[model samples]
Target: MKTNTYDLIIVGGGILGTFHAYHALKKGLSVLQLEKDNFPVGSTVRNFGQVVPSGMAGEWFDYGVRGLEIYQSIQQEMDISIRNNGSIYIASDTDEIQVIHELSAHYQTKGYDHALWSKAQILAKYPAMHADYVQEAIVFDQELSVEPETMIRQLHIFMQAKFEKYTLKYDTTVIACEDGNEQASLTTSNLEVFEGAKIIICNGYEFKILYRSLFDDSGLEISKLQMMRTKPLPQIQLPGNILTGLTIRRYESFEEYCPSFGTIPVPEHYHELRKYGIHILFKQATDGSIIVGDSHEYAAGNRLDDLGFAVDTYINDLMIAEANRIIPMRNDWITSSWSGFYAQHKDHMLEVDVSPRIHVRTGIGGKGMTASAGYAEQSIEKLF
Candidate 1:
């Protein structure tokens, strides 16, 4: 028989929503996750799938640590296409080295296991990196890298087989939600109604759709990025997640080390790249293909066409040119390029309780993959 009612109703099937389901199942609650499309095709799959807690700050860093634990636990239980590969931040100049030293102090204070590799040590292990450009490197051994395209699908499959009470319905659009003391009613696009004790909305970028009034009133902005993946290159052997000087300014964790960490000036030739918030990060996938990216563009009030959503060749060219300078990769090696959009706010996340029984959570920004598992567990605990 079809389940007419569930213990919890989760909207959206992205990583955030799926993690919420995982936690709810741990609570022994029957879950029904609704996805508008066949599967999640959002920032969750578009990202680099890098879970580097070293790039986050404050509570977010803690959440990242817990998420890392969750990912590792799942890996022990199943074949989730996970990689325990670590991350390395290559400092090219003295200024970048200063940022690394400051960040190292904070990591040590927090008891995060890390090591500062000298130029000689870095070259000895990864000789492919330019010798003159590398001054030092910070090695984070606990970080993880996952296959973005398969992780979610594999997770969903695992949930279906593991939890008999869990149900995932795709191509099901939740049109309206009515909250009450006893139970919450969700009306789908087909006018089919289902009941659940609680409703949680996790539709990431679709903030304005289900709750238009609240989203309009809230100060949520749209952030778009342009990224590319290269064809499999058998010659290159990347040591781990490769981060450059631009990333030092981009991630908040570095700034926690030094408030003025992001104040370094951009070189004149890279003015156009800086205009779009371009950063060069390279990661070798399991298939030996490298994932290269990305430039940030902020759209106010979800402006879809004002450069943020569009994939401009000029901006992509600048990113390719910059990546080439960093690692000397062939421009023609780029096999595919695309754009991704996500909801962002100045705050850590946008969590709103529409009613006593209805809650909406999103605006996780770029830390979705890194912090979702831990954050969702805490959210579910508080909700119950």
Candidate 2:
């Protein structure tokens, strides 16, 4: 392989890296993006494909809205697949219903139209739901979903077309980054070295390995979430994003900015069994198949074992039970399941640090997809 130099070098090919690359190229900076895998085999592709903004903190609400607008405009201006399928956070219990009411009030104050639904209205819209299980709902008509894998693939294509000078090297991993005061040199796994005036590390979970010294005291921890995709049920009609009261409690805005009802304790019987930190978010893909899941388990590395299977099964069972309450249909055909890891810090906001020529962006928490474009733009403004 030949060694080359560029104005900017991005360390990861995931959504964040690609997004930053796209923005950087638009600034007319010669850019190169390196990825260890040929395709995005990370959490970027494994997630629910949900570009959710409804539950984000107030500080990041604008970023979410901006990113949502970017996705909505991608098809018209650029090349990408984004579906504004609209999402709803359904409340089943009285406490959850109260949370929805509070969220509606906060969103209205923020000029967002989060529609508050009465039980009668919800029943009229979704008659499949068990009357007893649904009390109210908050519908975010602007929330959307996309096939993440497809989006990434299309982004690369679009980048190639728009920025003919941009370079993308797949199956090339950055083994080491030497950050000097003026510039950085990136040595790849194949012994290929590239130097850039500026380098942005967007390696997601692999950040600790590349910059362990910088983050030694940052208190960054990796969160592993298990998720599963169910077999397509021809009869099931998932109208929107489905969530319960637990989601409202976990999301800070709903608790602090919105001041929702007090947290409800999980039943003692299900606490240990379910490991239910928050409620499940169920959304259907363009295909009839429904993607259900999600249980948070934090660890140092992306590791899995037989014990995780039990927990995954428990989570799937819980989601099925909740889905049945809303849409009673027992099609227990599970197609496949997998787990992914995301970076989380004490503060949910992403951090961007720039020192002359070197730039760093990370700590997106789980909202990377939701605010990547806006965050990348912010980074660009600060760096340039």
Candidate 3:
């Protein structure tokens, strides 16, 4: 290949795109990454950054664990901050308590050491938590979190430094992609053209816009989620990522893989997809502020402005309410809140469709942070 050309051109510089670039370079492939935005402001940044392996089911669980190992290795080798603070799932109801017990038993059988914590034990370990409503809980010691935006920025800088020959073009949008006999050509909005032997689309929700033909029948849609961060609270101390029993009831790992938790009724609006429960994951930053979130709303297009302030207030109030139940803290200031979009697939499995010289990785759903590295590696291996 010529110096200006590349062996692979990756569109969308999110975690998935960056990981694809990283691994492709490791395989000795000249790579070029393009992003429309200057900074990663999508789901990659607007998340709790929790890598919960125990929450993943079946093959995805293995992938999550392997990805964590890779993340740790990379953190050590590359000087990044990955906090393995662990995670705790609090059960506030009788059914939720039963689910925690059953999930603990199931994870133990699967070689995972998720421990069941009695209400007293939990309250003792984290005295800030309100144990009155929590009947039981589950703790996963291997779970971890990171500052998502910082990690992406550092990774982008590191990739550019380590792979000087690899190209990263920001403020550049891939307008069209065409496949020829031996290579794929991409035309950017700036009218610049780049050619590569292979192309991988990791554009998240925008994947449908770029490759409409492939996604039209694949059951892929966009999910917009809301998240918020509270102002600094000196007294608050979260021991780990916090999850509610509702999460276990919704995630497949709690149901099919473990077969411990009984089904909680899916919300009426989300009945078709069988999605219920709110995930109130809390993690404190270095600045003594807590970031909590998220509720899902799916649509066919990018819809950020449609988020009602009332909805934001409602969710934030709910998050703080849940946090106070788990930790004894009072939040006075609401620092900031925002929303972002991610891919939602019907099967809950990421799919990589390959043409002769082109590949597309979509359907990451909400697990992009946890599964991107492993998924990207597998996609590259299948492509080249």
Best by lDDT: 1
Task: Give the lowest summed-lDDT range of ten residues in model 3.
Answer: 268-277
**In candidate 1, what are the lDDT values of residues 1-384, reduced to their tens digit?**
133889999999999999999999988999999998888899899988888889999999999999999999998888787788788998877778888888998899999999999999988877777787778989998888988888998999989998998999999998899897799989988878889999999988885468887887667788889989999887777856788877876788997776558676656766777798898888888898989998888876456456445588888889888777667677689899899988877876889998988999988989998999989999999998
Sliding window of 10 residues with minimal summed lDDT for model 1: 301-310
Cα-based lDDT at residue 22, candidate 2: 80
Over 157-272, each residue of candidate 3 has an lDDT whose tens digit, in order, gives 88888886689988888888888887888888877889998888888776434766666566766776767787876676775677765575666677775444555543443342
* Residue 11 lDDT in candidate 3: 90
Assess candidate 3 and give its lDDT: 0.74
Model 1 CA deviation exceeding 4 Å by range: 1-3, 259-263, 305-309
Query: What is the lDDT for 88 in model 3?
Result: 88
- lDDT of candidates 1 onward, in order: 0.86, 0.73, 0.74
RMSD of each: 1.7, 2.8, 3.5
Q: What's the true lDDT of residue 342 in model 2?
A: 78
After best superposition, candidate 1 residue 250: deviation in angstroms? 1.6
TM-score of each: 0.96, 0.90, 0.89
Ranking by TM-score: 1, 2, 3
